[model samples]
Target chain A: MDKLLRDKKAIVIFVAPAFLLFTFVLFIPICQSVYYSFCNYDALTKPEFIGLGNYKQLFTIDRTMKIAFKNSMFFLIFSVVTQLIAGLILAALLTNIKKGRDFFKNVYYLPCVLSSAALGLLWMFIFTPKLGINQVLAQFGIKGPLWLMDTKGYIILPMWVIASVSLWQYVGQSMMLYMAQISGISSSLYEASYIDGCTKAKAFRYITLPLIRPMVATAMSLNAIGSLKFFDLIFNMTEGGPNHMTDVLATHLYQQGFKYFKYGYASAIGTVLLVLCLIVTFIINKFVKVDNYEM
Target chain B: MTDYIKADGWIDTFNGGEGAFSQQTYDGKIYAVPLNIAAACVFYNTEMFETAGITTMPTDWQGLLDACEKLQAAGYTPLTISAGTAWCLSMLAGYLCDSEGVDLAALDAGTASWLDSNVVNATNKMVEISKYFQETAAGDTNDVATANFYNEEAAMLIQGSWAIAQINGANPDFENKCGVFAFPGTDGRVIAKSDSLAMSATTKNPDAVIAFMKYFTDDTAQKYTAEVGGKIPVTTVEYDASKAPAQLAYVMDVFGSAKSTFGFYNESMASTEAGSTFDDAMVAIYLGTPVEEGLQTVEDFYKNNVWNK
Candidate 1:
């Protein structure tokens, strides 16, 4: 094994399959999208080279593009902040509980495993004004605001509703990561802190949180990328409707590419989404400050 | 392939007569067989109409508005439409545009703008009637909106003939109470579309494909198209009117008496993008964008995207 690790040829042989697979499957398509973003390709005709035209239209004249960008940014910020706080609290609570820790974890994680498309439909029914939530609200003589239909503001009500749903479905993932990291910590540290007159909250703040920094970075990057590319939930819920008030970048790209057959423009949107995901991940990694804790 | 199918002779045999093959023709050559024709019109609840004391069917826009007023006064939601499904709202906009005589040819030719008086009036008319839509109109899917009509929660639904199957299927009891009429003030012009089948240019078995295509227009299938599917058969065929869903008979009468027929504006636009942009613009209007600003979105789309292309 030591000889194999030292050999350059053995290293190439071991790594070549995954390297080649990544180049063909991921790298090539990304390059093609970048290329298509600069052309006039409609998926039916041969691409005509029209440099910067699609990007210009997307940035300047496309009104829905602005809405999509704003909505995506909203989702990214909302998901990161809420998931971190909620997941950490849940993790801390579950760890300290004397009973029902596993039960609580499983219940929260159940939504994460279920299909987002089905969840989207279920939530759509629940939020529809004449039906689910509003129906219940009416019995108390309260008129529920159109939960998914009101499009009166810059960031509309439906976007907030979708963000909350997404948070509900995905916060479990971050919680589990934090729990794993928290459980790996030495219990002796808690005993030592208790002897030193440190409260459980202070111990959590000083010891558990620092030990979990690496996991937090991992969980947050996952969340940032996931929320930036959010599609299925919004697509199945509102289909970016009430006049595209809820369109994120992915939904806009889908409508342009598949529905409208504007492949070139859609590719431009896809490229922008890709850049956003990368920049967000970079920012999250930088801010979270993951370090190798000698625990 | 169109070259392999020998469509001209077969198309001539269609019972719908000369114009039956018109939609399938390209450069004087027929390439596909249409299974059924569909038209968009208003389907109303007769019982609800009677309850509202709407003695006369609306013949014009004012009468339609009056009918809505009476329905509202009688404590019924007058209309149910799916603004969530953009195409459904756009179809309604198409009828209004048809009634306003917004010239598609002139728009394409750059002789007319989408903000022209005719287009603006059509949008204004749409906004006026939209008030009668159910409270959840902006978020209801087509299925939900259709369910609203079949469940008798709303007095009327403006939908394509294809909804007949869904409506009857969801509530068989709705059949007895449903009535149909062409969109008011359109002078009987109906927005129509057809389900068409075309042979693949590379298919190896042309004879087999042709045999399958012929079956759609044959007497047995054409009759089923009307009696079972509740759609207008592309080929003329007679079936027992009593056996068909009651709404089918009303739809047939409207289709038969139409003074003119036009395609859905969203489906017939220069490109799918322009059509959807048009849909988005219509929805913006529905969601309370000023009519001029909403229509301006489409006009700008046409100038920047469609015309330049």
Candidate 2:
């Protein structure tokens, strides 16, 4: 078996199917998008090469694209940070619990199983100014700001509200990742620490944190990429609105390509997003390398 | 392929008001069939109006406000709008622009600026109307707004005549209880657009598709549009006016008596980019951006992105 696995012909045969699948699924569409980004095409007419014109116009005249970039960055940073921290805390707590672990796990992960669109609508209803949170607030003689309709506090309030909803929906996912990593740790290490009079908090900081660093990096990278391309929840909830204040790059690309029939311009935005995701993931990979920790 | 299709006698012969028909044409070849001449207007609940004591339909801007006030006084939300879909809000802005006489042709010719005082006045009026909308309107989607009207929670919906069928579909009896009216303006002007059917230039069965297109505009289909869909029929086919849906008759009457009518502002524009800019600009005004500055965004969009392309 070892000799067969080491053969060059066997290696090619094993890798070919996945390689072909990736080429057609991801590589081909990306290549097409890159080609379209340089042309002026509206789907009804033949593409005319405009060469950097779409990018120039997007950066200069398209105001919403700028706002989209800002909003995408906010979601990537704020939502990722909150989800990671909350997931870590929850996972740590769940690990130490003696009973009802599966019950709590199922409860926490319930939202993750629901569709993003459904979760978005639920949050939208919860935030509705007329009959949702505001009505509840009014009963206590308190005035609540409009959650989805807000424009003045739009850049701050609605963004965080959406981020929190996203956090609620996906913290279970990160928690599961953290739990898997935490479970793989040898129990003997913790016993040794206990013998040396190490506290649980101290053990976590010195041992668990270092050992799980690779998993954290993986979780962060995955969450960051997902948030960067965030569309469905935001599209269903706010639709990048109250004056385009909540637009992420994905929604902006859709508006340009589908709504406005500017295929070339949308392609340019898509290319930028794809490039940005690749660079960020690469940086995360370079920095967060896993090694066996020696205490 | 072109020779084969042309040999099969597939030529578009649809003709209507230039604005209504031109959307489906390109380079002097008719690419589509004009199905219905539709207009944007306010659909109101008749029972709600009587409860609010609005006896006569408004024909001017001030009277519309008075109706809204009465409706509000009667403890009903006066208007249900979907700001979540920005174009619904823009319909109001477009009507105001029509009232202000912002010549779209002149705007296209680069002879008029969106920042003109008349356009500013129109934007201000839109802001005034925004106050009467439901408190949750800014967060509502088109479906939600329709549900508000269907459930009798709101008195009015500002939408195209196409919403008539939607209303009927939601509640079969809503057709009799509902009423339609043109947007009140200084000169009784209204804005219109159309639903059209277009054929693909390359087709496997050009003859079959062309036959269906013709059948789609035949007398029976035209009358169904008027009687059932509440849409205005394009062809000159006489149907019993009394048998038409009450809302349909009212819409036909409004179009008949209108002092002027313009094509929908967004559809009349050269490109969808300009159309979307107008929608976003209206949203800006509704969000309390100064009227002039809001119009300025459209002006910038038009001058920089749309015009001279």
Q: State the C-alpha lDDT per candidate.
A: 0.89, 0.83
Error of 1 at B13 (Å): 3.5
How many residue-pair clashes does candidate 2 contain? 0
Error of 2 at A8 (Å): 2.4
Give one digit per residue, the lDDT tens place, for model 1 in A191-236.
9999999999999999999899999889889998999899999999
Cα interface RMSD of each candidate? 1.5, 1.9
Error of 2 at A122 (Å): 4.0
User: Model 1, B76: alpha-carbon shift in Å?
Assistant: 1.6
Number of the top DockQ candidate: 1
Q: What TM-score does each of the candidates earn?
A: 0.96, 0.90
Candidate 1 residue-wise lDDT at B222: 87
Chain A alone, TM-score for each of the models? 0.97, 0.94
Best by lDDT: 1
lDDT of candidate 2 over A99-202, digit per residue (tens): 99988988888999999998898888888775588889999998888788777754657888898899988999999999999988888999999999999999
Provide backbone clash counts, one per model.
0, 0
In angstroms, how far off is A227's CA in candidate 1? 0.9
How does the DockQ of candidate 1 come out? 0.66
Residue A186 lDDT in candidate 1: 89
In terms of lDDT, the poorest run of 10 residues in model 1 chain A is A286-295
